[model samples]
Target: MSIPQKLFSEFLGTALLLAIVIGSGIMGERLAGANEAIALVVNTLSTIGGLYILIEVFGPISGAHFNPVVSAVMAYRGLLPRASLPAYVVAQLAGAVVGAWIAHAMFDVSILQLSMKVRSGTGQWFAEVVATAGLLLVILRAPAARVAAMVAAYIGSAYFFTASTSFANPAAAVGRMFTESFAGIAPASVPGFVGAQLVGAALAVAISSVFAGAPVATEIEPKPNV
Candidate 1:
C-alpha cells in the first residue's frame, strides 16, 4: 500500500478503537452500577476483540500499528520504513481525537467529565510502563515465536489484570484528550503517559537489540535447476 493509504487505514482503525473503547465504557457504567474497574475491563476486552479483527484487516497493509510504540518497535526491528513515522503518528492521533468526540456525542458527556480519569498517579504510571512494555514485547516476539494471536490475547488479558486500564496507543493518548469519557486520559497527564509508553518501547528495543541484524526473511533463493 502507498504511504498515505496505509496511514489512512491506521487512522480509521484508531478512530474505531476510541469509539469502541469509550463507548463500551459508557455502556458498562450504566449496566454495572458505574463500576469503573469493571467498565474498563469490559471496554478493554471490546478493544481486544476489535483489534483482533483490525489486525487481520489492516495488518497485511500497514502493519496495523495503531500505537506509535508498536510502530517504533517495528522500526527498531527494522520492519518498518523510517519515512512513514511522522505521517503514521499524525493520522493515529487525529483519528483518536475524532473517535473521542464521537464517543462523547453518543454518550452526552462533557470534556471535563470525559478527561476525568478513574485511575491515575504513580502506581498507575508504573502499570502503564509495564503494560506497554509487555504489549510491545508480545507484538515483537509474536511472529517469530509463531504466536501472533497469543500476543493479541495477552494484551487483552493484561489490560484486564493490570491497573493501568488503557494501555493506550501513544497516539491514541493524544487523541483521547478531546473528550471526557471512561476511556479518555486527562490532557495534563498525556505527556507523562506518552513518555512512559515511548520509554517502554525504547526499553523493549534495547532488550532485543542484540538481534538487530538478525535476518527477517525466511525465504531462500533457489539454486539453478540445471
Candidate 2:
C-alpha cells in the first residue's frame, strides 16, 4: 500500500481502539455505579471485541498497528520499513488523541480534560513490563490466523491480571491521560508507564529470540500493494 494509505489505516485503527477503550470505560462506570470491578469487566469485554474486529478489518492495510511500540518492534525486525517508522508512530499517537476526544464527544462529556487518577509505583510499572512483554510474545508466536483472537484474549486477561490494568501500549497510556474517566491514567503517571512499556517490549524481543525457533509470519506483516 502507499504511504498515505498505510498512515490512514494506522490512524483510523488507533482512533477506533481508543474510542472502544474510553467509551466503554465511561459507559461501564456510569452503569456500574459503585462497582468498579463490573466497570472493568465491561471495559475489558468491549476492548477485546473491538480489538479483534479492528485487526481483522485493517490488518491487510497497515498491519493494523495501532501501537507505537508494535510499529517500532516491527520496524526493528525488518517487517516494516525503518523509514516508515516515524510516520507510523506519529499516526498512531495522533489517532489515540482523536479517539479519546471522539469517545468524550460520544458520551456528551468535555473533550478537553486531564486524568487525575494516579497510576504509578513499582508494582504498577512492573505490571506494565509484564503486560507488554506478554503481549509482544503472543504476537510473535501466535499463528497468523489466530493473531487477532490471541491478542484480544491476552489483552482482556491482562486487564485483570496486571496491577496497572495493562496500559501496555504507549499510545494507550498517552490517550488515557486525556480523559478523567475510569480508563484514564493521570498525566503524571504517563512517563513511568511509557518507560516501563518500552522496557517490557525490549525484554519481549530478547526473550522471543531465545524462546521461539523463528519469527512466525503473522497478519501484522504488511504486504505491498500490487
- Give lDDT tens digits, candidate 2, residues 162-222: 9999889999999999999999999999999999999999999999889656656653478
TM-score for all predictions?
A: 0.83, 0.94
TM-score quality measure for candidate 1: 0.83
Roughly what TM-score does model 2 have, to 2 decimal places? 0.94
Residue 133 shift from truth in candidate 2, angstroms: 0.4
lDDT of 1 by residue, 52-133 (tens): 7777777777888888888777775678877777788788888887777777778776633447554457877777787787
Q: Which number leads on lDDT?
A: 2
lDDT score, candidate 1, position 161: 68
Output the worst ten-in-a-row residue range by lDDT, candidate 2.
211-220
